[model samples]
Target: MNKDIYFEDVNIGDSIPTLVKEPVTKLQFVKYAGASGDFNPLHTDDDIGKMAGIGGVIAHGMLIMGFVGQAVTNWIPKKNLKKLNVRFAGMTKPGDTISVTGKVVDKNAENNIITCEVFAKDQNEQVKIQGSFEAKLPKKN
Candidate 1:
């Protein structure tokens, strides 16, 4: 929302600003559970996670998706987002640092829309989520 990004200024391979999230933490999972009403013990209780054979508590997929959403909205205004979709690719554990990135994949000059391929990867280069989005940008005057 800082400035309008005109469609004419962006190329098919242009990179969007990256968003880096703080390390994942137990407290964040608890907070997300409270906010999202996803009280699944696998995300909140280590013992339950261990019992379920996951080794330890895992971060909620939706929470990671929220991080990806933040990345999208940080580059384009939320109101201009026409489509945003993601596939949960892997589990995120506490202390994992996530970075969200995107590249322009396609565009529609007539409709002023830009399509982007987006993803969230950890410090170790493990992909946690992969997705794409479409946003409407202003036409150059």
Candidate 2:
């Protein structure tokens, strides 16, 4: 694990470490479905996905969002995260590699809080998720 980031350690506009994940896979979809209890056929069954007119199976949006969350927690501890908001912008299919990145957009020393703008994009540069998060970091004594 990385050392804890204090409130004074980061500056507005600083870039967080980028997180690039392996290509989405059918087995991963199945595992995510089992863990999230979302057995929507579109995520696991190609036939159902075709029937839904999505061409083929698409990954769960929440799974992509989880990737975004992972990027944030990679930079700061999980306990520091106070708020996370995201919107699904595009579908992610099996075989698509997703990359999550963020920039620190705001910082509040009074509350030791920092806000970041975050995004997840496919290898083709298509946006899959857009979001923001707030983290209250510890202050140096």
Candidate 3:
């Protein structure tokens, strides 16, 4: 079970625990396609990808966003999240190692909310997705 993160325990600039995912794989993409019902060829068909201009199959943007979401919920319980958003900045291909990191950017003690700036980057430090989130936290007694 996830413990409640008290608002008093977090400070601006505090780093959230990082979540590093294993390298992207074709099988994962296929599974994601089935699970999401997004049968886009660019995500599951390499030959189609080559024809479309991208060199090979690319992972779905939502899949990468899911990774970012995991990073947030890992630190803040799912029920606490009030807002979560991301922008896809780059394509993620098979073999790319994704690392998600975040830092506390703002905290409203009166509102019991914490805002964070979060991003996902590949092995080369190329950002694939960037976003922010707000979560309600308990107050320490």
- Per-model TM-score, in order, reads 0.97, 0.97, 0.97
Error of 3 at 102 (Å): 0.6
lDDT digits (tens) for residues 60-134 of candidate 3: 999999999898988899999999989999999999999999999999978999999999999999999999999
Q: Candidate 1 residues 21-136, lDDT tens each?
A: 99999999999999999999999999999999989999999999999899888888888899999999999999999999999999998899999999999999999999999999
Task: Give residue 108's error in model 1 in angstroms.
Answer: 0.9
lDDT of each: 0.94, 0.94, 0.94
Worst 10 residues of 3 by lDDT: 1-10
lDDT of 2 by residue, 1-141 (tens): 868898998999999999999999999999999999999989999999999999999999999998998888888899889999999999999999999998999999889999999999999999999999999999889
Q: Count the clashes in each prediction.
A: 0, 0, 0
- In angstroms, the error of model 1 at 8 is 0.9
Candidate 3 segments whose C-alpha is farther than 4 A from its true place: none
lDDT assessment of candidate 3: 0.94
Stretches of candidate 1 off by over 4 Å are none
Give RMSD to native, each candidate.
0.9, 0.7, 0.8
Model 2: residues with Cα > 4 Å off, grouped in runs:
none
Quality of model 2 by C-alpha lDDT: 0.94
